[model samples]
Target: MSDSLKVGLPIKYALSYRHKPTADIFFPDSTYNFAPFELVSREYFPTVTNPKGSLDSAIYTLISFEVLSVQELSLPVFVRDNLDCTRVFAPIDYVRLQGTISASGEMDTMSLKKDTQVIPLSQQPNYPLIFLFIIGLSFLGVLTFWFFGTPIKRQIKLFRFKRRYDEYLRLFQRLSRATDDKKKGLENVEKAVILWKKYVERLENKPFTTFTTKEILDNLQDNRLSDALREIDATVYGGIYSKTTASSLNILQELAESLYRKHRQVLVQST
Candidate 1:
């Protein structure tokens, strides 16, 4: 062998003979034949005996060795019969078999036979794309709720307020139509005024139901509202019925409508 040896590489050498001689061959174990290598394993296959006793179908041997150092190497193998007879001749002896190991370690390649097929692998899922799609859908849902939720809430509040205002106006009209009978008309007007005060207190978040005429005017800063309530109070409490009682009730109705319109306008502008 001419090239330098390398450590930890398995080098294999195999030999087969055509003769069916009654003998066993052994690989050399001395350092002279394998100086830089260590014997790893050996294998022998069953002899294929021919029915016609042909020498060509006989014994086969395989051996493996691992390179252990960097040094010159020479391998000599011998064949001997069971009767201690040795064959040092050309076809039986292999004394000149030699080589070196200098290449990097690599595994042997395997080639498939003709018409063999390989299975295809399945594709992997794209996780990033799926995550982005879910995020986009969530953002769209939040945006849609934010855009339409406010206007719907405001419209519902306005509808409820209109229904409540209509109820107050209907009661005022009922009182105004009863003005022909003095005691009954005064009672009806007093009830209507009390209902109006309670409704305004709820709508404006103030204590109008507990306020006197002067207190109501002072808290609201509206002279028209005060004058309208005073006229109704005089007719009911003082028993001073006037011909303009219906018009006084109309003035209270107008004042309630004005307050409703102002509140509605503020709600609309905010939305």
Candidate 2:
């Protein structure tokens, strides 16, 4: 027997007899009066024996029992042989077993203590890291705009201005070629001047579209712009028959080119 017995474990009990038995072996009724164990299996083995030329038969009984509960167990065992018509006390008088029901190993059932406490758990988001990541992205965006955004914007503005300037130059050339016809030359000059004013209004964010020719010249404070506009307006409105010379139109073109260059310089410096 082990020092400690685990519940549900089987314990074997065996007994051998010198003479053949008439009936199967069994525990007495008293054994079940307070049964705390189950009988799992029972077996009997018979053998012929020879002692000093005398032959006899012997029987051995083996019983397997499983412990059912935790308690101190004591049992008294008695056996009887039918051939002798006699009752005898078993060689083992008393069987004692003791153990606990509490879990001990992987195979044992789990037991809970009354005082055990359970703590609640929760997951929290890392707000600081998220905020830092957002700030880092914002700073990167600003730096990118500072380094590359300005140059791209300037290039686009210059391209649009150059296209408009080319259109004005072609119109001026047509006006100069129409010098032989006074009315036709004046009409082309009027169109070129109007187109130039509209482009300047857009580029400078000015009121050139609403301004009179005199007002435009005053706003610009350029003597060359004033003279050129006056000559074109005289031919268009005053019905003047005087032809516009190529030299006079070239002066106006130079003035427009100079103004475009000035505005472009301002854009580049601001970036």
Candidate that would win on TM-score? 1
Position 28, candidate 2: lDDT: 36
Clashing residue pairs in candidate 2 are none
Best by lDDT, which number? 1
Listed in order, each prediction's TM-score against the native is 0.45, 0.41
User: Residue by residue across 107-226, what tens digits does model 1's lDDT show?
Assistant: 454653576689899999899999999999989978877898798788888888788888878876787788757558788878778877787787688999888888788767565666
Task: Evaluate model 2: give its lDDT.
Answer: 0.60
Q: Give the C-alpha miss distance for residue 18 in model 1, angstroms.
A: 60
- Tell me the TM-score of model 1: 0.45
Candidate 1 positional error at 271, Å: 3.6
In candidate 1, list every pair of residues with a backbone clash: none
lDDT by residue for model 2 (166-229), tens:
8877876776677556447667656666766776787678989799877777778666776677
